[model samples]
Target: MDYEISLETLLQHLGEEEPFPYGSVTPPIVQTSLFTARTLRERNTQQGRNEFGYTYTRVDNPTVRLVEQKIAALEGTEDALCFGSGMAAIASAFLTFTESGAHVICVATAYTPTRMLLESLLVRYGVQVTFVSGECIEEFAEAILPNTRLIYLESPSSLYFRLQDLRAVSQLARAHGIITMCDNSWATPIFQNPHALGIDIVLHSASKFLGGHSDLLAGVVAGRKEHLEPVRRTRELLGGVLDPLAGWLLLRGLRTLSLRMERAHKSGLKVAEWLAAQPQAAKVHHPGLPTHPQHALAQAQMRGYSSLFSFETHPIQEEQAYAFADRLRLFRFGCSWGGYESLLLGWAQTESDANGKASWLFRIYVGLENPDDLIRDLQGAIDALTP
Candidate 1:
């Protein structure tokens, strides 16, 4: 029988309907630490699956496994591993693949904690990293060495929002026999499939789009079994397994992912377009924008854009950014986005000088609000900022 299902069908199957044959309509959270086997042989088999043989929730949980299977279906991968948080998933994937003295190339603006892992923790253990702008395919190619084991990327990077040419980067990584990993949180599988573009591993902070409500903290990595095994081992060993309740919440979030993403795509474009009209807005960066440097590439690879995007303004200072942010009533000033409520974050203090010239800018995570109301809020906030 053919296994392929349309995206909508996949969403319903993978997100809502658990493969578990339990009689309950809602999946009963498998909140047990141990499963009782009826016989010694059965116990032996199950034990082998667990600690000395399957005895703990840390190693495996039916609830978490269901979430992994669903994400795997959405991401078009062979298998997946789940983590307690986004950084935990990232750490498991890298720590499993990389050893002391392994050389890696990465886009400069990957998630800050991811960068910290490479530069701080991994470096102490002998890993060497080269941060490249990833402006051209050749940039990564030039950075690779004989010892380079992996190429890391975060397209439409978090704060900076730089778009990497995934096809070009994946081709380069494959040519050199190096594995490719990308943070796919921004676009989610509903908007873009990194696997279809030839990426080897796709990572997500399911806390963001996959969890959808900003309620649960979770992460997932999807790829071939070879890559997933190491991640699973690392997660199991490191005790980063996601809880059953969080897994259930993420499953609930995944149900409306298609609808939420579609609305985000349209609303995000409208917001980006409207932001382009503001006088204080120096430049707006979004893949959906015709003026974005990588618009063509984004359009080619992504099915649609999401509400998360960044905008840089002329005022120059974290204070100005925060001032504008504080004035907004609808857009809450905080981190951790992808909810019914919109969020705004000011530039990191490291982004500015003592003299107050803003080196970086604010990012916006638009929510399911009326576009006209959002614009009016932005208009009032911009007007509030004074010299």
Candidate 2:
């Protein structure tokens, strides 16, 4: 048996096994709040254990634990912990590691909610943070405070698609005894392995790729057993642990992740290349593009690309962006991606309009569709946008 089996193979069998003789290939969802032990002594004995112990759903559940174990193995991590949402996993990792006075260095173009959590909530609690471009390793080194306790990264960053040097940053963090974490949702394990680059913690918005459908809201954090144990304990204490049904769904979604991701990569590149060649397009950002500043780094680190990417166009006005978006028939307007449906999000009202944080740029998630048809659709949309 090869430990390094194909992702398709791993997806099929990762967490679907049953413990009993029911002969059910699919793992049953243990939907109860609590479990009963055969005896008090037996319960006490089981409580002393780790994976096999399952006293409560919030503390741990058999179904959810199986998902954790499966993801841990897939990520080449010692253990994993699931959460109600991606933010829960992210916030818990911070809370578990950093105290009130600890410092963190983060990317400026991070996920908006994560930025809010760091700036508003964490700063209010005495956890100071520094934001940087995250393009060069030296930026991270320059931002490090004496009390810096953690470093967070999101490669091919949210809006700008800025790539970070994970190995360099991780090495710097390790030298200073600071914990390193990256949101791995964008790359997934199929594309990049942050752990292999010496990152201590890896986070995911399972609601996107891991779930492989737009229906579920879930998250997972993977890392060494020592680092993740505290996060697991904190999750148990905070009551943000994943439920059994979501775990089962996630397990089911991952069954076709490898296949879905391959198609996504192919379609993504085709779309990006098409966009790059368009006269109306101002810029297209994707790691798969050779024109991307960090394309070489991405090639060195990742196995494949995903469909989620962004682009810009010469709009007559902000309204043109929305007009272009509305003209498209195949791409539905949606907030999140990694599902089977092609989606697009139009730019929001500008910061000048409402003193908002900032306006959104055009973002697209290329679903499994014909590349030529999608290109045709995009061309018509762009044509309609010009005044």
Name model 2 segments beyond 4 Å from true.
2-4, 15-21, 44-52, 348-360
Off by over 4 Å in 1: 1-4, 15-22, 45-54, 316-322, 348-360, 385-387
Compute the lDDT of residue 161 as modeled in candidate 2: 79
Lowest lDDT sum, 10 consecutive residues, model 2, at: 349-358
lDDT tens per residue, model 2, 217-236: 89989999899878888998
Best by lDDT: 1
How many residue pairs of model 2 clash at the backbone? 0
The alpha-carbon root-mean-square deviation between model 2 and the true structure, to one decimal in Å, is: 3.1
Provide the global lDDT of candidate 1 against the true structure: 0.85
Q: What lDDT does the true structure give each of the candidates? A: 0.85, 0.84
